[model samples]
Target: MRLRHITGSEDFVADSPYVVHRSERYRGVWNRELFPKPQPIHLEIGMGKGQFITQLAVLHPERNYVGIERYDTVLMKALRKRESAEAAGCRLENLRYLSLDARLLPEHFAENEVSKLYLNFSDPWPKARQANRRLTSQVFLDCYTKFLRKDGTLEFKTDNTGLFDYSLESIPAAGWTLLAVSRDLHRDPVLNEGNVMTEYEEKFSARGNPICKLIAAPPK
Candidate 1:
């Protein structure tokens, strides 16, 4: 899908303090540089308009949070959302945003640096030829191990059943363990506890789509 480029989005992110420019320099020392002090780091990939991760940062001040998005236009929107959230008196000192591709994750984060990882409504890349492009694919799972802690859990939510079924098999085949699985997230009290809905998630749920969620962890 072609992204609709918003005018001047580039200039917006360039001037924002919330954005981490030249993020590669902070690799292996995120806590030492980006954050105030060392703490558990939670990261969200493909943070659309910054709803989920931003709320997580506000809801859990004890942990550091980072939201990554590759598109400058999308990242710009997230930056604006951060400003609005701050205006409403949200303490976001522990939150940061990065405009980078998922493939570059290792360039800005050290091995075992992330305690929790989130992949919310990522492109399923349904075509069989595009399996490797899917965020829940085994290939991507192997890439995540570079920065995710051994016990770190990855939470994925999607409305696609095919992708969820593939992920159920992909996780174990990639040598990871599935900690939890939910077919209908809103109906599952345990899994839905404290759940923060994304901008897209709300739309999908309103249409009566049964959101599927899975939590997986890398090898110990």
Candidate 2:
């Protein structure tokens, strides 16, 4: 699949007021000192338009959140939501955004730094050759295993059956133990209540497509 160019509006370097450094030392210093407490460092990869993370930050003030979206054009929307929340005195001190490729994830996070990782409605990348590029591919899961805490869990949701099937197989191969799998997220009212729907999730569900959700935890 061809990659689209990210616009300047969503460029973190160009738009984010927070210090977004890629250096390991810089990340350590910021996480330890700059950010408050840093107890629950949950990561939302590919946060499009910011609706989900914004709601999460608003509702859960105790857990710190890190949103990573590479596409600047799409990322700007999430940033705006954060800015608005802050302005309104929502005081979501636990939220932040990073603009970079997931491949560079290890560079910015220390070992066992992340508690939870959320992959919400990432691109299907429908072609056979693009399978390796899927967010839940073995390569990416391996990266998560390196940075996530031993008992950490990965929550993945998508509307694409093909991608979901591929992930179910790939995650286990990468050494993660699949704990729960669902073909229809909405049918599970308990899951639905806790979930903060993404822009794509709403759109897909509105169109009557069943959302596929799964949770995998690292081996004990």
Q: All candidates' lDDT scores?
A: 0.92, 0.82
TM-score of each: 0.97, 0.91
Best by TM-score: 1
Question: Tens digits of per-residue lDDT for model 2 on 28-67?
Answer: 4446754787577889999888889888888988888888
User: Candidate 2 — what's its lDDT?
Assistant: 0.82
Residues 1-220, model 1: lDDT tens digits: 8999999999998888989999889888899998997899999999989999889889999999999999999999888888899999999999999988898898888899999999999998989999999888878898899999998999999999999999999999999999999999999999999999999899999999999999999978
Q: Which stretches in model 1 have alpha-carbon errors above 4 Å?
A: none
What residue pairs are clashing in model 1? none
